[model samples]
Target: MKKTAKSLLALLALMLFSLSVSASAFAFNDIQKDPGKSYIEQLQKKGLVRGDGSGMFKPKSAITAQSAVTLIVNGFGLNIDNIRFIKEPKASDYFTKVKDNAPYAKAFIIAQLNGLDIPRDIDPNGKVTREQYAHWVYQAISKKGEYAWIEMYMTFKDEDKVTKGYMDSVQKLLIGKIASLDEKNRFRPKDAITRSEAAVILAKGITFVKNTKPVPQPEQPASPLTNVRMSSEAYGTEALKVTISAEAPHAGYGIEIANVAYKDKQAIITYRVVKPDPDRMYPQVITTVAAAVYISTAYTPVLGGEVQP
Candidate 1:
């Protein structure tokens, strides 16, 4: 019986550890198979986001401008440079809603100090749309620089549908791989941003700020890869196809390409060995590269591609 008790205690400890780890990933009630789960957990781990104290993240719930600004301020580490004031600015001075003891009071001040274009009469609890959040986050990162239009092709079918004054904001984010299209190749800029999606955008936005240089950068040596092509199409939903041809051909079974992310306005593709193909030992090994299809607007089905390596 003593041995059994010891075994039970060890099992209990292991279970507790697993629960703690899972809790760290998300104490939320939802988001088990959520694509945004990793991003949300990342921000939560960094202490830039949080669930209700009772342990519910409300992942699908709409986020507010009030909370979004706070997340931007905290997640991007913008509060490091304190804004001076002739007088200690009260929340009322900047926002009509936020009181000194209000939950969003400090965030409003940080947004003000950081020069966030928050109007005094703005509704604090209004649900923030994708375009609205994009504009604000873009400003926070750029330190309110005049957004330059890169003169890139607008591929999203509904690019014109973006709310006024937010097209450049969305485009800037798209160029940086922070904001992305829906599977329908639509920006859906006017849609309310869910907490889950907000987490992903904010995390990526913050990373972009940290990595960008203040000055123009010289180009790096191009990869040995060639004929890198990207295309967008709709299956049941929209999909992005990234085709990369290698300098030389690779084995059909061994060559695999992955990590189709956006970089420098190109579909950044990564290749890795999934496993060895000992069975395909033909007379000779031929070099070839594989094309990967990331399905969905955010990521989805592959548009057909051919890689001639």
Candidate 2:
């Protein structure tokens, strides 16, 4: 009985040893010398990435659109947890090519709801170019939070190859060091990104989000209408000039005459507050801003609904 028990104990020990080795084994067979090995490993550990059924990452393989969107949604921890729905959302509601039963469909739905610029008919299995991935990942980052971006344009060798709409996103990624150019100072915007390269860029974006703080926007004081006055004067015409004035906290805030409506013998002048230009500087003192619109002297001038309060 003692000898039989000893044999069973030995067998159990061997089995335990094998399980331990399996758990410690590398997740993929092809990532050993890949440039993005470390990042792939990090993502694997976080459950943000996985290898093929054959235990190969295929680092040089092109990343598909579905896979890219899934990674961005998962890597950035985006979800619809906070949003309540009367009806459960489905991928088909937002995308045409994505099937409701597809594994990555939910990710696509989340991406669309978050405003990632995905087309309605995007193919899930289609390969994405470097600029395309960059644009999507940049949109994800923006949805996460707003960060202070340096006000400078980054010139690349293939600058002209970039899509006009994606220019700002590419510039932002380059400026933040989340992505870089090749030795030739080329972004290779049109080239399809490999799995390894995508992992590296995504990992960098995740790290940036984790470590960076969002810049808070300062609140502007309300623009209150101080007065609206009318006078008659224009180039050799019997016109009535209606001046709409308001008190603004800074010179940057100004009022503009949006529309003039004639009703019941009254010239109603509608005005709207023009927000301060983001790229311009202004003095931070109380200032009176005004706008004038000339109308025929046939009707009395009155302020529109917008100028009130």
Candidate 3:
């Protein structure tokens, strides 16, 4: 009886470990040695992308506009807060075949708010193209009014073959250095955005958004430099604060400290782009505004007395 009980306990532990592995990393038979394996796995871990009920992640199959938009919306963390609608919100009302409770309904609403333009007549189930996806992403970021586009001015040989209406947006993608060209310097704007390609682009967009700096401000000095706190914001406005942890109040140490941080930031941006991927055609352009984090230092008096009416 004792031996049997021990055997049962060991089997239970093995079963639990097996379940854990499946929950975290489903063994998709199709994506065993695919190039986009890492991207898909990364998204899966983030809960932004999932498999189709079964334990398969059909990596090569074409994903529809609705599904693609849903991935993009979730992957980029788009949300609605104070939106107003004249009628009851329904996907079918705005789109031709989309239903109210459909999987893509919420995504359609959120994506539209961020400048994704899927026509009412178009089928949401239709496969999304590379140019169309790039255009929508460009439109999403264009609303921010930051990040001056440094256009390469180098035209693609197959530029004319790209679909109409998406030419300008696609150009912005190249100018902003988000999408890369092939060895022949072709953007392949007319091709369908494959699952692997979509995963890579969407993942990179998350990085760009994460790299955005907040307008930083320093906490009010506690007892005049006894305690000072600062934050490095990732998104929104950019800000910086300089301080000197001097042993005595008469020290001129703040200026020396500020110069080092400023120089470090510049060196990071310059040397960071040195890694050359022959496959990547675009320059490494993070979606962020320039002229952020200007070094400024000042002394404010610490008032000990209570406020007077």
Q: Whose TM-score is greatest here?
A: 2
**For residues 122-184, what per-residue lDDT tens digits would candidate 2 score against the true structure?**
999999999989999999999888999999999989999999998899999999998899999
- Quote the lDDT for 93 in model 3: 43
Candidate 2's C-alpha runs over 4 A off are 1-16, 24-26, 217-309
Better of 1 and 2 by TM-score: 2
Model 2 poorest ten-residue lDDT run? 227-236
Residue-wise C-alpha lDDT for candidate 1, range 1-309, written one tens digit per residue: 999999999999999999998776566656667789889878877988888876678888999878888898888666624322213455775566777788878888778756576766777788988888888888787873343446675679887778768877788888878888888888888889999889989989877766665555465544434443343445455554434344333443343564555421224345543334567644444455554555444532222223233
From the highest TM-score down, the ranking of the candidates is 2, 3, 1
Error in Å for residue 247 of model 3:
52
Per-model C-alpha RMSD:
20.9, 14.1, 17.8
* Alpha carbon lDDT of each predicted model: 0.68, 0.83, 0.59
Instruction: Select the stronger candidate by TM-score from 1 and 3.
Output: 3
lDDT at residue 296 of model 3 (Cα atoms): 25
* Candidate 2 lDDT: 0.83
In order of appearance, the predictions have TM-scores of 0.59, 0.66, 0.60
**Residue 215 of model 3: what lDDT?**
42
**Alpha carbon lDDT of residue 140, candidate 2?**
95
Candidate 2, clashing residue pairs?
A: none
